[model samples]
Target: MPASPDRLPLALYRAAQVRALDARLIAAGTPGFELMQRAAQAAWRALRRRWPQAGELCVLAGRGNNAGDGYLIALLAQRAGWRVRVLAVGDPAQLVGDAARAHAEARAGRVRIEPWSECAPLSGVLVDALLGTGLSGPVREPFAQAIRLINASGLPVLAVDIPSGLCADSGRVLGEAVRAELTVTFVGLKLGLFSLDGPDRCGALRFADLQGAAPLPAGEPPAAWRLAGERLPTLAARPRNVHKGQLGHALVVGGDTGFGGAALLAAESALRGGAGLVSLATREEHVAAALARRPEVMARGVRSANQIQELAATADVLVLGPGCGQGAWARSLLGGLGALDKPQVWDADALNLLAAGALAAPRGRWLATPHPGEAARLLGCSTAEVQADRAAAALELARCLNAVVVLKGLGSLIASPDGTLHLCDHGHPAMAGAGLGDVLAGLLGALLAQGLEPEAAARLGVWLHARAGERLGGAGRGLAAADLIEDIRHLLEEHSPCLN
Candidate 1:
């Protein structure tokens, strides 16, 4: 099958930044009203494409320009000989400037307009042009009720700009938000649309720059970038005479007692991820099982932290903390690696130990992968707080830990200590299984062992891991973590070929 076109832009902005872009456009040449008209036209086109058979449109309008887009879309539907009605959720009389003009145009165009009430009947397609990105707090009173009505209507809803009651800076839902089947956003893409709860509420998203043939206005740098296929870092093709020693060795440490499988999974992934030599130093009990499962991996039985310290001296990178318990054994292993300067990828129990003050946070070129819960612990806050503003939490963790931090969850964020951030909007709900984090840590270790910088290795490893899950996620449920390893290897080759 042919590849899908890249509808999503890489550059993502905060709500304020997008508004600034709009102002710059107006300052340069385009009139505010013309821009509003263009937005409506674009939305109308998308709506028609999404539901061509639906001949009726019920528009819920507010007092802002977002509602103005609804009014213009109503006019477009009316002109097209389709039945249309504008439910004035925000008093139309309160509209001003270009919004007022839009309402007047709809009125002149003979579109039926009425005040929105709790008992208002809804039918056909619903256009949610309510709060947009102007929501400063939780949804209040009548608008909240209106959003509830729209969500309960069981009608196909198209949200203009952004869904109401969602924070444009963070993806947190503010009290209530309209659940739309399609969202047509304009000017610039907002970062919130791809983070946290934004993906669930926004549904299918479509972006229109509205600049048309005009060059994109350079306002401010992007807040963060979306990791995609284009402009990715690639591994150089190997030389014909290269030997096994040329590639780096990666050591996997963890898996105490009952948790033996976790460390083995990491080691298996490291070998698959192209590490020249992979070693697993775990509890003596797991060595036989590890060798049985994967003979290629050099599995060693280690009883204490001293054993791992010896292994670390020859390893290029260490993939630490998968199934590493919080007992004294786990503590000893963590403490032993503290003085080592080897690059590392810390996940699972390693993070818990660090958060609990078991050892000072490791320095040097290292990467930390923490789920929202782990992130909250590291920040000394609640998980709810971390989820509320994930971008902020990730950056803060990166700064404090002095290492690249990967906040893994719905939208995985890779934040570098230098203040750079990247968001991976790939992966699927089916990937909500166990062992995925262990696989990711090992992949990062393999990439690091191959000589990529901490941040670059993290970015590439995350993309590869998530893309593998997405490819296999089509089977829906029962997605095992080990299933992603082979697919990741294949994808790595496709992205960065082995040979010229």
Candidate 2:
């Protein structure tokens, strides 16, 4: 696929939807057979480019047009003098329409077609052509066995469009889905390709518009947005005339007793992220430590809610629950602040509190950053349910909470109450260490205080957090939470809109 900026993004579709698209294209002018040939050529081009030295392609063929694409690819590879073989998982004689023609073409090109055997010589790249998007229930018998073999084969397997047995719309593996080394998709990008199990399954993605010698007409709008640095802009440089108050004050809430470090991290992140004033309302015990750590922050020892209410009253935004415990004390303080109508970000134990059914989402403009377990609590379901389809779960959280929901994970999904989705694919696994979510919540609160809309704030904050994590990747291991704020501040300067 040629890289182009104007191409339409992908939509998650069922096998039926893609078929409908193909039928529409055929009725519009192109023939069905021609489309099949185009899809085959596209897959072949991608395969060769990725595995330039590897030869002798073994295509796993099944029934339907997906199998037809495999056959055609085999023919194309043979023409290029690469030894190619097709192992039929289904009856080749039973194939009808365009697929039958493709099989005949492969035979003419001297491509060997044989019954699939567990002992078949595994060589070069394995092309998974067995199951196309029509799959519903878990993968059964033959296909399941085939998928297991493909995964264990250790060859660079290229899936035709979607990997066998993976749901095209949800990205869930039905029983099991082939983990492809590279996935070459045609027409629109699949929504499933960017979320849930999709990211891990679809290794490196490439797109091919077989119908377009140039570019296809802008198809249906993308089902979800793929957030990238190029699409989002950062904070503008302040004018010399600007004052501290004009920049916005952000309050860091929660640091009960032994957990003061979390609150201090949030305050420091807000300060580094451009909040005009950063206030830390934590336990009296940790006040001195916070002040000593970050002298710029207005760290205070709040014995009761009374002491912090004044700071909360004046705050432009509140970053709540970084290290909040679900104890009675934490609940009491949060209960008092719940109706303050401030643009607040709730994370960690605050999310757990909401999940425990103690506090509810506030009416104020808010951002809720929840990892899978916390999300499951708030939604009253198991974590596995949320991971099964992250896109839907995030959107549901946004609508139910009436706040921007940043469901944090591999491909962090930011969902708005209005149904807009932003997928963030940038982040390192080292970010899996503690306090990362706290850093994110603080960054989000900082953005809201700086005057971005809830959606914009959530989107850009996540990008900043992820980009910062990526920055730490070179250090190798032990990604401590406190290490990110300076890097995030640097990234903000690097990505600032006016600078660009």
Candidate 3:
């Protein structure tokens, strides 16, 4: 994900919303051509800052306002005494409205403009103005070839508004998309720029609300919100007289046979995440290890569903299915928990079992955290379908299960039963490993047990987990799952201090 500055807009809009806002700005007296000029200026400033020493420029121009921005940028470069060339990918004569006007301005300024050719030399910074947010279908012909050539050229690319051929709503690549080193977006923040393929294609994002567009009109709500520390819910300072019984007890149930560590990891995470008390119910063989590793948790060895009933009866929240296999033991544990009405955090094999129809979805306040593969299984779709529009998948999961859903991925999405969505743009690729999901499930359970609503708990837990992964991921690769627990605890205290 791009490094977000504190001043960037938090609301995420779809392509249509951004366009509507653009139209609104135009209606409010700012001419479309003027806005296009502002976009060009923004791109020019960002380009100069990023590549000040690169005096030569090459711009790939299309037929839309995006191309207009490119043309104006080329003119700006020419006026600045920098050698610049505009490669018109679309017919220059076919340019319409403000785009045509921009072409005329570039021509009047004696800016070098020529038809795109395969032999065009990609020099200095390459400006991608091929397609914009208006693109809806797969890229075709010369544009696709041009994007490929630019990518292959290994030049520092600056994209206008959004990278060409990327879906502005879904962040999906349309056949092919430009990979930009920096992207200068305009108006409202596009939803695609921070999710899915957006993060990979847009290296660093800079926003400029050209024309100083007013707040969105009534009834024009953002598609989702970017999760940030300032926007997240914080826990209140604890009372000095608080006792273990005052805070909720969290029970972690899993670890069938060979997967004892998964359950232990969850239990340990819950204990460290500020849960008043944490208890572990797993296979008998793992009890000694669990007790030795974390004596604070009341670890119990359970052999059957009947044995788990007593443990479940006393717990305030349940963290189920870390390393829980699809055998009889896992099924029995689910069945035992099914009779209770406590808040629950279900993950791993629990999600698998629910997808397989072996266990019913929980009826109480619950949060379901599933990766794309598991989400695909739960939704009865392919993983590609889930990744294509992760927000939709997450919303569907929340609606179907009537639970808060955390769709874990590059931009982790949290969907509420009310249809609201939030995206966590934190985390690092190095955190991709076994046991992270288990730790998240435990963290969610702890937050719930500490009295946060299901949605609040999911949001805070996901953010903490991803942010911790990002901090530890700086070391680059080989990040263990256990490495995140301490960071999460520390971050929680920092964000929601005990004495603040």
- Indicate whether candidate 1 or candidate 2 has the larger TM-score: 1
Can you write out model 2's per-residue Cα lDDT over 1-500, one digit (the tens) per residue?
A: 32224343423443455556666777778888898899998898889889988877999998888899999999898898888889998889989999999999999888989998887877888999988877778998787888899999888999988888888766788898999998887655776776668778878787765664322235543446766665785677787778889988999988987898888889899998888999988888898999899999999877666766877998999888988788877887787777888888999998899888888778888888999899998899999889887888998999899989999998798999988887776788789888888888888888888888889898888989998999897688999988999999988887773232
How much lDDT does candidate 1 score? 0.90
Residue 365, model 3: Cα distance from true site in angstroms: 0.9
What is the overall TM-score of model 1 with all chains considered together?
0.97
Q: Please identify which of the two predictions, 1 or 3, would achieve the higher lDDT against the true structure.
A: 3
Measured over all alpha carbons after superposition, the RMSD of each candidate to the real structure, in angstroms, is: 2.2, 2.8, 1.9
Using lDDT as the measure, which candidate wins?
3
Q: What is the C-alpha lDDT of each candidate?
A: 0.90, 0.83, 0.91
**Model 2 misses residue 410 by how many Å?**
0.9
Worst 10 residues of 1 by lDDT: 211-220
Task: Report the number of clashing residue pairs per model.
Answer: 0, 1, 0
Q: Write the per-residue lDDT of candidate 3 for residues 187-256, one digit (tens) a residue.
A: 9888888888998898888889885746667887788898889778898899999898877999999999
Tens digit of per-residue lDDT, candidate 1, span 1-500: 01124667787878887887788788788999999999999999999999999999999999999999999999999999899999998998899999999999999999999999999899999999999886769998789999999999899999999999889878889999998899999987888888988999899999888963333455447788888766667788888898767889999999999999999899999999999999998899998999999999999988777787889888889888998888898898778685678899999999999999997676678999999999999999999999988888999999999999999987899999878889999999999988999999999999988888899898899999999999999999999999999999999999988888
